[model samples]
Target: MTEKIAVLGAGSWGSILANLLDENGNDVRLWSNSEAQAAELNDHHTNQHYVPDFHYSESLTAYTDLAAALDGVAAVLFVVPTKAIRSVAQQVAAVLQQTHQKPIIIHASKGLELETHKRLSQVLAEEIPADLRQAIVVLSGPSHAEEVAKRDITLITAASEDTKAATFVQQLFMNDYFRIYTNNDVIGVELGAALKNIIALGAGALHGLGYGDDAKAALMTRGLAEISRLGVALGAQPLTFIGLSGVGDLIVTATSVHSRNWRAGNELGSGQDLKTVIETMGMVIEGIPSTKAAYELAQQQSIEMPITEAIYDVLYNNADIKQVIPQLMRREGKPELQ
Candidate 1:
């Protein structure tokens, strides 16, 4: 049976997923908060601003009305930036309360909430009525929006405490080109997804600062160790760190040109100021915010996350990026894995 799926946020990821759902023979309603963007998508079947060369599925419809897009949907896939999750969830809760509809909640954007340091799903649970949705699923992995838009072989994980909800999401998104895996480790999945962005930022900074592959290898290895440490402290299974949501995600985000976090860090390493980089990129770099949140979390939990702290200093404190390289190298010698 085909389900009516509401895709909130008309960014590259959201648009591509909506098109994929249409391809999978589902009724997809693509919602954009911007009226102008919604009009362009509906009239032109394109979201050229975010994905300039990709074509959207004509069968998929676009809407500016949140309630209307979700009118009869079975699930919602949120692709907005991390900062926007709370506001959007509140709106969804209001709409659902008004319409008395309960849809499976799924989020694709990554990054923990600032100050609160809550995951996207956690934020949703706090804002949305508990009876609105039995469980919230998180979709995350190494897949890039550009490649996924082209139907490249991409794999992502759907995670929730409810295995049934995760499996349902896997079934909803899986196709010939896109594979989905269901995991009950929501903590591991979301933490891996959010934390890798910080590592990716460091990787890009290293690249921009003229470091070679050897440096990147060391950075990723150590980055994963710290990620695993923090994650395990927060109740994530250590083995999950070696899986798609962990190692797989770190490799792709740290290496891919399509990653906004990598690109932003590249600019920072190239000597651009944070304000200028943000203005120039014209998109949300999840890593920057994630770095801050991770840094705060590490301090509160007393977890050692050196890479995250270095990146946070660079982004928030105007610390010299080039100088931090030797500083890291000069740190007292320690075992490879702690």
Candidate 2:
């Protein structure tokens, strides 16, 4: 069956996924905020600004109007940044209300709402009424937009409390190059996906500081501990931390050059100011805002996340990266499992 799907946000990840759906024989409507981006995708079958030198499927269409893009779609994927999730979800709710269409709501975005400290799924649920959506799903794992654009083999998890919903998403996205796994641990999957970006920033900073593989290995190991601690405290399954969305994502994001958070952290450790790095990159470094949210959440939960605190200080407090590294190293040693 050829399902009509609405993929919101024409960023690199969103555009790639939209193209993948088209390849999988679906009617894909990719929505972008900019008229030029929409025209580029529709006319040239390319999104050169985000994913350069790549031609998208000709059957995949682009739209600037949210209502028209979503008209009669069976599923809607939210791929916008965490900061924009609420506003976009609100608009989606209004459109669905008018059309009386209840579609499956799936989000591939990671990171919590900075203001409310709520997960993206929670924000979507609050903004998009249950009556207007069949179910909420989260798609996350070690996949990167650049690699997926190359048709590299990628595996990701689709999580939802509803088994049927999760399986439906699995079937929707699974293909020869892209494989999907279904998980019922929505909390763990979302937290694991969001928190890994913070640790990836730290890994990049280590690399920029001339630290070798040993330092990065230590950072990733201890970083997973911090992630598991906070995630478990926030009602996630302990075993999920060891799954694809957990350790798998941490390993890939922290070690890969394709990660924006890692690249941003490298610049920070190389002595560039945050403002300069952000402006030069011209992409959202999710770890910056995610670090703040995680730091606050750790304090509220009384969970000791030293790595997150260190990164948070560097990003938000103008703390020197060199000084922060020594401070982290000098902290009182404890049992490794604690």
Give the count of colliding residue pairs in each prediction.
Answer: 0, 0
Window of ten residues with lowest summed lDDT in model 1 = 53-62
Tens digits of per-residue lDDT, candidate 1, 1-338, equal: 47899999899998999899889989999999898988888788888889996778778899988989989789989999999999999999999998888889999988999869998889998998778876899999889889998889998899999888888889888999999988889899999999999999999888888888998999999999999999999999999899999999999999988988888888888788889989999888888888899999999999998888888888889889987778888888987767
Candidate models: Cα lDDT each: 0.90, 0.94
Q: After superposition, how far is residue 75 of candidate 1 from its true place, in Å?
A: 0.6
Candidate 2 lDDT, 135-243, residue by residue in tens = 9999999998889989999999999999999999999999989999999999999999999999999999998889999999999999999999999999999999999
* Best-fitting candidate, scored by lDDT: 2
- The lDDT, on a scale of 0 to 1, for candidate 1 is 0.90
Q: CA lDDT of 31 in candidate 1?
A: 90
Candidate 2 positional error at 284, Å: 0.9
Shift of residue 232 alpha carbon in model 2, Å: 0.4
How does model 1 score by TM-score?
A: 0.98
